[model samples]
Target: MKRVTGIGGIFFKSADPKALGAWYRDHLGLDVTDWGGAIFEWGGADSAKGMTIWSPFKQDTTYMAPSTSSFMLNFRVADLDGLLATLRAEGCNVVGEPQTSEQGKFGWVLDPEGNKVELWEPPAGE
Candidate 1:
């Protein structure tokens, strides 16, 4: 049995939720709503389109680390360098250096709430 299809959605809790949402909207040039949340449209030129909804999940459970919160948000991107440059220009705290692996290319950035968002550049010929 082939399991379910690709990732349907990802939801995570956040601190300073409003600030986080606004940051994504401003720096990333995303269509985050005024009320703040992201609804993504997933489709390559040759692939069928699917909708992705994102929001800051409400956290009622205990923190995952000694002082850190639970969960992080990762976004797959095409132009990693461009995006990273833009993020840095906006004065975002870019954590760690960009890297490549068998899966493809990867980079990380931390949000205001200290959530690490991963950016990925898929391998060619996908």
Candidate 2:
């Protein structure tokens, strides 16, 4: 019943995503990828290995839609379905149906402040 294991990613809106990513890459020494993001890997082979993503989106992007917040927090979850169910039963503001992709499974919810929160369940061995 582990609701959240860790932070999966941090996404925010930027006036110019490409330039912003470059700034971070140049000034902060972040290895921003071509896709305009960076992946920070952690944990040991003997332990549970995981990654946290850092990315920026265009100001008009609708990815973080339904939320006017400048930033969005993505949390890693061990069991997306189970936790989503629990959240719904607890009167939480769970958003649309879950989605799956090569990255993993994703779900959404809105906090009391109306900020959109993303829940992710990574594929096995990731």
Candidate 3:
């Protein structure tokens, strides 16, 4: 039951997500995409390790709800279902039901300090 393998993404609330992304793109040289996020490939774009995402959302967004934190951390996991079940059994505050998309399985849990933590299991062969 390996838990957090590595950081999957970093999401934060911003007054102006586009502007902030642009700033990072211009100043920090991040390859901010049209959707206002950047992906950093580890090893390479086709690496088995996958990439990490950096995105910002609107300040009023409820994506990080149930927690008053300004940012949420997304962690890469080998087994989302198993890890989530283990977390729940360990008395961790597992959030909503898991979801699936092209990006793979996703789940969340609140940290002791109440920060929203995202768990991501990349699609097979990703």
Candidate 4:
């Protein structure tokens, strides 16, 4: 079972999300949108087109909860259910159940260092 195929997104907490986003837009030319983030699209030599999201959340947000880490990593997976079961069998700290949305199917797990990791299986043809 192939686990993580690629990074789906990178999310981190910021003291001032607006200001920080603006800085990234102005200085780094990240094309930060009004929602305070950017989507990067890529196509590998032998891979299908894919996207990776970059976003920052307010410092007080509880999205990365159950872990005190300032950031969470979202990984793209081929099979969310199968990989999650494999992680559980391997004694990994898998968290929560899988969820489906227009964007994709999502799940969460905590690493040994207590960092919350998000797993995503994007909708077909995405």
How well is each residue in 1-126 modelled by candidate 1, as lDDT tens digits?
998655565667666778877888886666787767777767789875533334455686432222255665667677889999989998987877889888778777777776667777777654
For residue 80, what is the lDDT in candidate 3?
Answer: 91
Q: What is the clash count of model 4?
A: 0
TM-score, every prediction = 0.69, 0.65, 0.64, 0.65
Report lDDT (CA) for all predictions. Answer: 0.70, 0.77, 0.77, 0.77
List ranges where model 1 is wrong by over 4 Å: 1-8, 44-67
Cα shift from native, residue 58, model 4 (Å) = 1.1
RMSD of each candidate relative to the true structure? 6.1, 12.9, 12.9, 12.9
lDDT by residue for model 2 over 7-123, one digit each (tens)? 666666567788767645543346899899998767886869666777789999887868888787776777899878877886777888999999999999876556677889999
How far does residue 108 in candidate 1 sit from its true spot (Å)? 0.6
Report the Cα lDDT for residue 113, model 1: 73
Tens digits of per-residue lDDT, candidate 4, 12-94, equal 66677887666445423467887888887688888798777777899999988888998887767788888788778867778
For model 2, what is the error of residue 100's alpha carbon versus the real structure, in angstroms, after optimal superposition? 0.4
TM-score of 3: 0.64
